[model samples]
Target: MTTNNVRGHRRRLPAIVATVIATALTLTACGGGSDAASDDDAATAGAADDGSFPVTIEHAFGETTLEEVPERVVTLGWSTHDIVAALGVVPVGVPETWGGDDEGYSEWFRDQVEDEIGGALPEILNYDDSGELDFEQVLALAPDVIIAPVWGVDEVSYDRLSEIAPTVAHLDPENSWSSTWQDLTVMVGEVLGRSDAAGELVAQTETLLDDATQAHPEFAGASFVYGLTLSDGATELGLYIPDDPRVRLLRELGFVDTPAMQTVLDSVEGGNWYGGVSLEELDTVEADLFLAWSAGPEELAYTLEHPTFSRWAPIASGHYLFFEDEALAMATNGPSPLSIEWALANGFVDKLADALAGGAVTVS
Candidate 1:
């Protein structure tokens, strides 16, 4: 936890609700107009220019070079699918999103592929909640390259995947799952041979974030803590590190994480980056703003009624933000260009601004 005064994040969205498109994507959208053709083109396109081939890239595990631009890309881990799809290339396979649609896919990703690519949903890779990879299922996809550069694929997993295709694991062991969206976009773009396009994407995303802070100056002074809160008898608080994408996202929007919370995180000892604190220590970690992630409305409601939870300053001052939507949570957990748009479009900035302005707890 380098503690550069970072803060909180979470995103949950309803299903993509376009007039006809909404009804059409019941479970899968296979029979369609330009959508089918769009997917076909996106699925088979080469990632890089001819001159960009044989490019060597390094990661936590090792380096991989693509002798030729990859036509089939298989993405394992969060956010990779959207990054690839946003670049006008559809992955042949994708990881299971945390709170995706019934198809077990992120709404932003599903809609983008349907509306932009005009294609059927990509194959859902065998990725479980535990981040385990289904080696056999991944192998059947027969991808030209495997992208997991921002995921937590260990040595064994990397070694296995590398055997099938040139696999790119997490960029560093020290900061697992802490890869910035820019790094993820650029790396995936490089692997696909779309470095220029990737650069454009990063610029666009940065501009989007700049526009957000510019729109809401009130967010600048507030401090926040991003944590997951469950209402079960045992209520544990999962305090995400400052560098975690969720926390970094809030920092991007112009808020800072509290120093008190940083001390609590620093005391935590583990290879994994998050710290575990009891709800009893809520007051010990001070922040002008507090963001708590809940599984749903029911959970959020239950958490608010906890013995000590209700008395926390943020909660008492009504300066806290409770995230109850699963899709919205996933979007903020590790934002990509597409997911960030979804968060903004769905009032992420507005809620934070409301929190800074202060009146009642902002629950979304």
Candidate 2:
């Protein structure tokens, strides 16, 4: 019988019956080896004999009744792969290139996975351009589950992947890249029968963030701006309105976005999901701290020197923060719980701390 049928049977029991049955089956499966077991064995010990099973997770794709801890899993998105790898699970497949071959994996991520897995990389699927699902390659792995918790893959892709095995989609629409590493570890923990371990991981990260935030309370009254400039230098600005996860994180660090950015948030139809601003209109952004992404350092340097650029408030104030293009791109498109932490650890937190400490890091 298919895995879905096994889970369906377990889903029918009363709350107590379900929980007891699931727990017993999970223990039995845990005792057994990691290999796939017989249908009757799985049906009795996996789900049917016990309703509670080890742990079940309900996600956007469908409910996953993880009867036995999944040994061979596949991650469809780059961030999902990072999440699994961070949890010490070497997913069977991961995207070969996230943005470009040159900027594939975030530096810290590559190091973590390689160090743990001894450089034995998974099947690298190409997600460089279109960011859609590659069904054929994924099915061949015969994964117990697929993790695709990013925005690139739409609902149609989610449905197709569900046919092959359990697939987890984005946690929510607005918080697309805002998922905390702690929550991701918990999700992987449930799938791998390591919830306790996941909880511990969350606790550790919480301590780290708390420490970072506490170290720089001066950020409490600080204001900042963030956005990106395209190939030709036209800006696509996004104000992190109060509810945005990134903005929430900044608030935790005691920083607020500039008042002008708040106005843009108020004026936009969709509250500035993305604002297209021409090079000539650079004067509008008014903030104590200016942050923006560019194709590379060369382009960023040119924009700073442009005569008309002098009017941009942050540019005039000498309080701009510039992040590596590749890193920022990954943060924008390939964001995962782990990657966000990597951002914090590598520069985001430290840079802000430096600014608050009255260091010599000038915007120009």
Candidate 3:
């Protein structure tokens, strides 16, 4: 059995009364009626044809049935907005992205919205300083449906969001954030009544990855360990499990998991996507290539100089890559069709090639 470790990662929210009051005030100040109607029209105009109405979707929180094709949609998690927008539906509200561009949106998402979809950008539902989701903002949007297939939505939050609209939680009841990009795309397509389009998108993405693999034979069977060192003074290393999206993406690119990863998985006792290993035992988690992200240059330097970590095989042989660009890291962490295409168009593939060649490399 696995435990729900979400509370440790996310902050508890404020009381409902305060959230309601804030929602009312914010709506009143923004002339909610007219603005909402206009946004709704824009979103509806761009949406794909209505699928069979009254569709029922089973999720972590029982089941939710959509009586009709939804117009105004709200998304709460990393790739849901991207998938929705890619399927030709503009979301009315989307959770703020941490490594996003200046507008709290990913570059690919913005490009798709502005250049391809030609619609107004969705409102960003920002978390508070304490990492609390802005429930007030979500309520103010008055979305017809809420998509959160890979979010950390607990029972209380699910019930509350259901009161606002038909809310869909994560796919797995036992794991909060374990959905794959393909599954998410297909699910969102089903919700939007565009399964055919979703399938095509998936096929195209697969072809893109396949072509990359064929082009770079070196990636095939290349053992790797993807992880990160927290800013907590580099005391421990966080290794992503096989089920994690980041690791899945690497596998799709033709990389193989190191034998050490199975040992880490055996040690992990819960549904948590990551497991920790002390810096002292870093050498035990061996791999041909070590890919990771750092808080900054200082942290990277500290990790490289650490007594135990410095002696790790990959680091000693310079077969390691670190990313300082949060945007790139986010793209890889939860890849969508849009982000994958953008990443390839950028220099992500080339960077991997460089890392495989050997030498300490960092992408800033």
Winning candidate number (TM-score): 3
Model 3 lDDT on a 0 to 1 scale: 0.75
Better of 1 and 2 by TM-score: 1
lDDT of 1 at 212: 94
- Residue-level lDDT of model 1, residues 1-364, one tens digit each, is 0001112332332222221123223212332212232334335222343356679888887789888767678888789888887776678888778877777887788767776656667888775678577888978877889888666477898899999999888887575588899899889878876676677767767887899999888788678888867658865577788878999999998888887765667656776667866778777878888786777667776777777887888777777677666777788887998899887777677777766655444344
Q: Give me the candidate number with maximum lDDT.
A: 3
Model 2 has an lDDT value of: 0.54
Q: By TM-score, rank the candidates, best first.
A: 3, 1, 2
Query: CA lDDT, every prediction?
Result: 0.72, 0.54, 0.75
- Determine the backbone clash count of candidate 2: 12
Runs in model 2 lying further than 4 Å from the true structure:
1-54, 97-103, 117-119, 127-131, 173-178, 230-248, 267-273, 276-286, 306-308, 328-337, 344-347, 355-364
lDDT of 3 by residue, 1-364 (tens): 1111111121111122122223333434553222233534435222233334568888987988988667788998789998887766679899777678777988777767665657889998878797777787888988889999876477888888888999999988889788889999888877875565677778877887898888889999999998885564667788889989989999999999988887778767677888877777777786888889888878887877877787888888888878877777787888888778766666677778778888577877
- Stretches off by above 4 angstroms in model 1 are 1-47, 127-132, 359-364
